[model samples]
Target: MAIKHILKLLLQQKGISLLIILQVAITVMIVSNTAFISYATLQNWLIPSKLEENQILNVTTRVFDNNIDIASLIEQDVQAIEAVPGVIAASYASHELVLDSQGPGWTMFKDTQPETDYRVFGYFGLDEKGIDVLGLKVIAGRRFYPSEYIKGSFQSNNAGVIMISEELSEALFGNGSALGQTVYISRQRIPHRVVGVYQGKMLGESATYSQQQYHSGIVPEVLWGNRQKLNYLVRVAEGVPERVLQQVETALYHTPGRMVQRVEYAARAKKRLWDGRSTFAFTMSGISLIACIVTAMGIIALVSFSVSLRKKDHGVLRALGASRSMVMTTLIKENTILVFIGLVLGFPLAILLYYFLMNNVHVQSVVELPLLVAVALFTWLISTLAVYLPAREAAKVSPAQVTKSS
Candidate 1:
């Protein structure tokens, strides 16, 4: 009987009810999706770089005159940077952090079959000391023998020895050991033997969806010559002062045939790379908060207005025998029905929006059914609470009031 009466009341006030339902629907769609996106981004952001980020510095230099003896200069610079009080170790690298930029890659295949499976991998050209410089753990085989280390640029070294990441190891050789296995670099017939396998090293952009991000190989070679830039990977000792970077920079400026381009901290480089995702998280958080607030306020306003207009009806019911608790329950039930209607519409809209985002932006906007149910229940509870005061006021109206008005 109460439900029928509430249904009639809702049918009479179509405009206000529709407006409130629309507000709830919009809130549900935006708040739920935004929350999921923000959380996903934050989770991705927290993934460890697996490097000594705080203790490492990348000091890049440009050679003004390519004619200078590149190998000698880099060797001297390494010695100088290592001599610093807080310096742990330093080495010359073609690149710094793996996440900073996509490095050199080669498409490799296990067989000569026409439809053979192949994988692309980014190679890091580093000297024997390079593994220690990046703090990479060689879990299998052995590090590059000092004999394997060559003194020329990557192209000229043509070194046939390389270190592979564990992921690449599993991909190429499966469960069996990858050590002593020879894999070809690209289409070239020459084979480079896998000398070592390291853990916790990543290549390219970790946040990207590329399969080759963690597929890394380290070539035991140094880059030297009329190169435009020289990359020095340096690791500082524990409790090193910030002044160590400036000191390192000053030392490089004194080196002949080179100009200091920039002394970059690994942590700073990572921050610059990840700033975009951080900004997106913050933006979505703000949007979700505003949507929730607007929806809550809309619920309050609509319920209050309905109660005000139905004062006479509430009075008539109270006079006939409806208790205060009964009047409040009826009003709450009415608001819950409206909320349910909005949720029914909002769920489909949310799914469509998620699909739109996934297709357009390529984000992993997977909608969990349990999350949807929780959001619905939460909104229903809050809407009922928002209507509580208005319901109480309606219940407080005396039967004599309607009698007096009539």
Candidate 2:
């Protein structure tokens, strides 16, 4: 009977009921996207790529309109940077973090003769210790040695000189061991050997399990564009202040080279992904806020009209000895019940939106539970705030005017 009474009251105020439903639905959707973003960021941080947090920094020296001996300039710059007081190691690579990801390439392997391609495959032309300074641990065989840079030594040294991410290796060679598999990148015809397999992330950009994306392939001793590569990375020593990294930039300035620029993680990687995600959240939250406010106002307008139209009914109830508190309770309880129902429906709706984004977009990235909970809680809090004012207005009826009026 109470349920029927509530439904009849709600039906009489269709606009207010619809406003409550819209507010709940829109808030739930916005919160779900926020949850997915939080999960992706936390997942990226957890990767065990041993970053040389104590004694490294990344630098990129570009050869603008002119062509020059960038390799020698890089060597000199690295030498100078290493001379800084706190610096321990220095190396350069053609890739740093996930900024410029190399696309995928593949060949049938056994049937191909000289594996030279018309294009580049994966990350090529890393300096000595590019992997190590990034703190990659070789799970098998040996790391690349400096002597292998020579032409004759290239073929001889390549017989035992390649390492790869274990995940990439497994993808390429399947369940069998990848230690000796002669995977060929169609770069230079020289078949560089895969001497070692390494675990932990490569210095820059992580390649996910995409059959379409290429693994990091070796840049053989003979390649055309190897001369102009500008990829670099640095690991800061633990507790090193921001200005400490300035030493590396200053050190490079002393060396005769093209202009090298320090890559800021915040401006680069975090902006590329996290910042955009945050912006997306901010823009949506603003829109949701507007929608919520408009809906709450609509509810208030409709409830006010309902109270005015029912003045005589309120007067009779007051005449029958109903207290103002009892009349206010009946009115406020009607909207509160609707709000509760909306949230009940919205909880599952929010979960569904979160699932759609996580599975459809970042599904490959991974979904986190804690982030979802926090976001949902935040959404609920905001919804409560939106509904509170409208509920309060309904509670503040002027009983004297209603009871005394016809």
Candidate 3:
């Protein structure tokens, strides 16, 4: 009966009811999508590289003299770095350190091709000690053999043995064994045997490649070319990375014809990589919070205005028989109905907005059902609270007040 009366009242003020409903629908659409983006960005920021990041350092060096033997200089630098106290191991690679945000070197590989059955992956060349320096765990196969190590330029494709991440293993070969299988790389279709599979969650050159973060492959090769700088990944003893960082530059200076460009802890570099995205996620969360507050304020003001207009009806109800609690409950139920209708309309709008973001923006997560349900319940809770104070004030209206007004 109260619902029927409330529906009649809402019909009499169609413009106000529709306005509140539209406000709620817009709020729900904006808040939910922004909240989802924030959640996904934070999730990406927390992904582990599966490396001994705290105890590892990346040392970048530039070779300026053309006459020096770059490969021999690299070997000498490696020896000197390893001899430093607290240093465990070090290896040179073609690319910058993992999580440096320099972007990835992408290439295509295939198990068997009708010329189209191929998948793309980011790759970098590493020496035999690269696995140990990066702290990768070999789960299904062996690490690169010492004899497989080679010295080559960045574009050199002469590696005969390749080690892939477990994610790539599942992507290319499914449940079957990837060991000893011949997969072709790049457009030249050069075939290399998969010698090993290791486990790591290292990001592909940048964090933007969300799907390809773990789709990495390492070859048993070290890079040296004209005007190309060298990147050395060093693993140190626990509790001594900072001490070892101080010594790496001096050790590298022992070898002439090159300059130590930079030496930094891998953990610090990884933080720098994700810092921008983390800030963006936090900013979005703040915006969503403000939107929720504004929506709640709107609901409160609308309900208060409606209660002021309905004081006479509330007074007559109390004069007849209705208790204070009954009046409050009826008012709350009416607002709840309005909120429910708004949610019904807002759900589709939220989905459309999500689709627009996925198509036009770089949203990384899919729509989650539980998150949507939670948003709905939260909206309902906010509306209930917003209605409470106004309803309480209206319920205080007595029979004497109605008589005096009349």
Candidate 4:
């Protein structure tokens, strides 16, 4: 009987009730999507680079003059960098260090012929010391032998040996061992032998959202060319990356034909690459918090307005043998029904919004049922609390007050 009365009261205030329902629906949609985005951002930011980030340094240099002996200059720079007090190992890096904004060169790799099954991978070129300089662990097989090292241009196919990450090994060879297997690079007719498989991460903007984040390969080649930028990876001893970074430019600046572009710790470069994601996570979190608070405030305002207008009705019920608790319970039940209806409408909107994000915005996380249920329960709780104070105030109205007002 009490619920029927509350339903009739709600029908009488259709305008205010509909407004509150719309507010709840919009809030649910925005909050749910923002929460998922924030979660995905944080997950991407936490992916490990699998390199000795703090103990390594990234140095970039460019040779503008075509007459300069690029190969000899690279060799000289590596030797000078290794002579630094804190330096452990240094190598000529054909590509920029991992986790940088610059994308690595990608190519197809296949284990067997008719080329039906193949996986795309990001490729990097480093010498025999590349594995140790980047702190990669050779889980299976062995590192490149000294004889395998060669000096070549970026586009040259002089490299005959390759090392792959564990992730790539699993992708290419499945459960079988990839050691000593001949794999073809790109469309080249030449087959390069896989010498080793290491565990490491070589992340870039293109691979950030894909399973290929760790699908990378390293070649035993010291790449240098006329009028091309040269990169080097330097590994320093513990507690001296900063000190080594300071001396790297001076060590590499032996002549004026080349320009030392920049020298920085690998850890700092990785952080710089991920700073955008971090900011995005924080921004979305703040928006979610504000949306929840605003929804709560909206519920409170609408429910309070309804109670004020129904005060005389509450007073009359109290006069006709209804207790204070009964009056409060009736008002609470009315708002509870409104909240339920709003949630029923809000759920569909939330799902539609999630799909829109997945398609257009490339949202990485899935729409979990538990998270949706939690949001619904949270909305219900907030609405119930918002109505509590207003219900209590209405329950205090006296029969004499209604009679006098009438």
Candidate 5:
């Protein structure tokens, strides 16, 4: 048959064509939503940190590392680690070095800007030695003056000075020198001057781009070393043996009254964030599957109904000597064309839902092309499965049984 004949037949059988198209459209919608949500979860699991892996081990002390008098003890412990052979950089950080709530950062406004809903900058109390250990780079302005380290006067020095990452600068002030401008920091109406801006050392990169999308486009982890903070981390030298790690662990074990029983990092980045995300993704997948199944069932029923209505026409074609294979192939070609038409219409809408709309709500990561291809293939598969049974039944029609006697 020519193109006109096929199109004319499709136009005549509008009800069946429309039913298949609608089912495909629903399948595409559900698949795109599921993909967008899945990727969003993956992005949050791996947050970025600048800590040098391979060389780093985070050590905790049950002792009063946070005690005021224990500040001297904490500094002494770090100095002792400095004496250890092959120990390159050892630093003490308050809560800043760890992730999630252990090192939370915020951006408080000078005068709260309702339009700009921002959090405050994270605080770090780094001694000169600890500063270099963290390896933070200055993009603009200078490091903290020594006078700022004095226990009492230190608060005065810190009251006005603030240091932050380049990402944060762009998030708050568009573009320009972030220096010299005083930014507000929460309920206190207190202002901290933007003394410097810096970039974080690339950390946790291995977690981001694995076979899974974990750490891509995550927020930079802020590193602040406070002497009073017990949550200290150390980066050992290369070629160092397990004996060295044992010695460090031994040092903690033999430290006077308190004991250091455990030291470990979470295998994955942020557990709670990704855990909730995974649950959400699984739920969406279930919903998507159900929607696709419902659509497939509807398409099959509608197509079967249409095939029954047009049974007499197929009988006429069979009387004209069209072989069973030829008749079956024609039906397959017709339905496949309807599917293609549905795809052309459904795909663009799926893309819009997955990208522009879904990412904004999820705040995870933006969905990309690979996800798009997955959704399209899934939608096509469901639609294809729906027409299979109808196609097989159409192929089994008999001409002589329907013909009238002359």
Candidate 6:
């Protein structure tokens, strides 16, 4: 049929077609955005933390008593934990895990020159063994020498030396080497020289929709004070039994002034984080499935009702030499026109929702024309399937049966 004829036929059922079009528009908008949200959530859950997640353990302790010198207590605890037989290396960290985003962050610039487009990265204070304990591989430059260690409980006023991850290096300097280069952190523009580049260091939560998570910078500082509670990262030797954690905990708690608040594997914490994201993804998937099903059912109902009302017309056309195939095609074409109209209305609605989410809610979403097109195609596919049975039933209508009833 020509486009104008199809439009005239659709105009005759303007009320029903408009209602179906609105239903389709709403369904497409919800489904496409939900699909994108689910995908982003799942990706974050699946990405590795870029740390020795399995072999590492976290031990957090705090000073329970006020008068106790926390610096001395932390030193004693570190010594005790390191003394455990299965421990390959141990180090203190001001942050529990870089993936948890529990530490400080700084906006860094490649050069000392001021610019507005600076990148943000996690800044952490770690001991010399922090890299080794976390199983981070120094791919370039060199680790901090003993003399470069920021000794004592309090960091000196000197500009600190630091190491960065390969991700941060690439972000700041691309493929070029970042070693021995200077970057300024914070508004003070404190200059820190990158001494080493390591792999598998994540600086923030994986779910964050920013590239800054991989840009981790480490400083060689003891970071122990009465006011500061440091977390211990212990690398257990291979073939170590589960009891090693208990032994390590006991060793740390053997000291008088401090208490071991928690001792657990890093994998547990990682699982906990991913669980939340997974739950969100599953919820979105459920909602998307429900929307598609409801939309399909609505389409089927509208097409079926239209077919019933046009039964006598199909009978008359068939009697006048319209073939069964032609009758089927007419019904299908009418519904297709409705779907096309819905797509025209739905695209803007989806874009408007995306804009509202991106601007007002600060959601992490990528607006892609192809993604929207794919969603429209899917909605049309479902609508076609729903209309097929109704269209087929209309084609089977007999002129004799309609004439006898009349």
Best by lDDT: 3
Give the alpha-carbon lDDT of every model. Answer: 0.77, 0.54, 0.78, 0.76, 0.61, 0.76
Off by over 4 Å in 5: 1-26, 40-51, 60-85, 96-98, 101-105, 108-113, 116-127, 150-158, 170-175, 186-190, 202-229, 242-247, 254-313, 320-370, 404-406
The candidate that achieves the highest TM-score relative to the unseen native structure? 6
For model 5, residues 344-377, the per-residue Cα lDDT tens digits are: 7777777677666534653244557788777777
* Residue pairs with clashing backbones, model 6: none
For residues 198-267, what per-residue lDDT tens digits would candidate 4 score against the true structure? 8857644445554367877878776665346888888888887365677888997867778888898877
lDDT, residue 36, model 4: 66
List candidate 6 stretches off by more than 4 Å.
62-64, 102-106, 111-115, 147-159, 186-190, 206-208, 211-213, 222-229, 253-262, 358-374, 404-406
Off by over 4 Å in 1: 1-14, 44-46, 60-76, 103-123, 142-162, 167-195, 202-204, 207-230, 254-268, 351-378
Q: Residue 27 error for model 1, in Å?
A: 1.8
List the candidate 4 regions with Cα displacement exceeding 4 Å. Answer: 1-12, 44-48, 61-69, 101-122, 142-161, 171-173, 180-193, 202-208, 211-213, 221-228, 253-262, 321-333, 340-374
Residue 328 in model 4: lDDT: 81
Q: After superposition, how far is residue 406 of candidate 3 from its true place, in Å?
A: 3.0
TM-score per candidate, in order?
0.74, 0.66, 0.82, 0.79, 0.65, 0.84
lDDT of 6 by residue, 1-406 (tens): 5779878878888888998899888887887777666666566657777766667898887766677776666677778888899888888787676444323346678766665457777777777788788777889999888887775656566436888888788988998989889888777788899988988465555324454557777777766553536588899987789898899888877666567777888877666655765666577668878988998898889889988988998899899989999998887788888888888888788778877876786544565567777888898899899889998999999999789979
Model 1 residue 102 CA deviation (Å) reads 2.3
Per-prediction count of colliding residue pairs?
0, 17, 0, 0, 11, 0
Quote the lDDT for 358 in model 5. 39
Superposed on all Cα atoms, model 2 deviates from the true structure by an RMSD in Å of 7.0
Task: Give the number of colliding residue pairs in candidate 5.
Answer: 11
Tens-digit lDDT track of model 3 for 269-378: 77776677667667767877787788888878887888888889999999999999999988888888898899999989988999897778755545678778888898
User: TM-score of the candidate numbered 2?
Assistant: 0.66
Cα lDDT tens digits, model 1, 108-151, are: 55655557676677667787677788888989998888777776
